[model samples]
Target: MNSTDSRASAYTTLSRDSVHEVEIKRSRFITYLFRVESEAQAREHIAALRKTHFDARHHCSAFILGPDRMIQRSNDDGEPSGTAGIPMLEALAKRDTGHGTDLSDVLAVCVRYFGGIKLGAGGLVRAYSDSVSQALEHSTLHVRQRLRIFTLPAPHALAARWENELRAAGYQLEPSVWEAAHAVLHIGIDDTEHDAGQLAAFTAALTSGAGRLQPFDTKWVDLP
Candidate 1:
């Protein structure tokens, strides 16, 4: 597939809340919290928000992204069921397509401080959803590109030259270190632009077709 066919991913925070007395705006400014590896990280975000807005009435949150959406979870805090969590979850689910296939194993939370204004169930839903939406609007999103890792082994004498050639050719090379009489090279190429013929030609020119390249797992990596 071409790069245009690639998916976009993002890192965002969940909500807006203040601990002390503060004015809250109703501009739909959800924090759009991002992917957290563990529940602990998710809680850390929650705790920090609480500390930041200690006097806020509620901190609603929802996180759904991970293996099988494995880490899916949401908290209404003190809000009515389906108001805070469900709306937040729905927002997350809507963004899943852009996140690619590995979007599972992620979490999100929306923290709301009452603002002394009661947002009814309908308003609450809009508020929660809008929070994420606003945050995403200002957030930096990245495209998740598929990369192919290859292990190339070459004699120490030719390793440095080979590495330089690959770099000059627009390939990313991992750190190469000497081991025994050979150097193991880790190379990454954008699968979307993968050209086996070009690779074979390069290898032929570099090692007279003697070098071996082993394929590794494909992964979603951040694009600059």
Candidate 2:
């Protein structure tokens, strides 16, 4: 699979950690969904769950890391090969949040409590996939975008007015920092040429060529 899709400017992930449980043929599948950023975090969560549910038959897991969703891994635990982990991984990989199937930085674990019923390979696959699907259904999703930070300095007299104007223009503004001579207004715009040009023009119009936007740092930020 491609590391990142060029279509969507942002990616989707779980809004918060969540749990959901589903039962099939008396077998219990308790799913835990965690918002993780790295392989270490994912492993830590998995280990914690294993300790918590130490008596469970299996603790199958799958995780996709990185903003690009490039790091993908899954574990079957004691379940048959490809029946548990692969399906769970596919469920997460194919999840679409209106933007596209770009879900990343999430780890899913399905703890199974065997109920004396044996689910064949197909049934096991369905059970694992359904486990994650049900958990996601109960999850709130949010978007993360790469934002370009810019600082625009304005005189004390016009700082508040410029802040209001920028907000009205739908620019994301951070709290302004007050300095001795001027107030520095921090803004976050989508890391795209279109947004950059718009912000530059707007700032120029506000300061009449006296003010310039200084590019700050770019980082991935969770959107509300």
- lDDT by residue (1-224, candidate 1, tens digit) is 55554443233222232221212454223353555657778778878777876776677777765434555778888888888888777776676444353343345556554555676788877777766655555444444455667778999888989999999998887787679979988877766444545665687788887988777656656556
Can you write out model 2's per-residue Cα lDDT over 119-220, one digit (the tens) per residue?
999999999999998899899999898888999989999999999999998999999999999999999998887788889998999889999689988778
Model 1 vs truth, CA RMSD: 5.5
Give the top-scoring candidate (TM-score).
2
- Per-residue error for 190 in candidate 1, Å, reads 5.0
The lDDT per prediction is 0.64, 0.91
- For candidate 2, the TM-score is 0.94
Cα-lDDT of candidate 2:
0.91
Q: Report lDDT (Cα) of residue 107, candidate 2.
A: 98
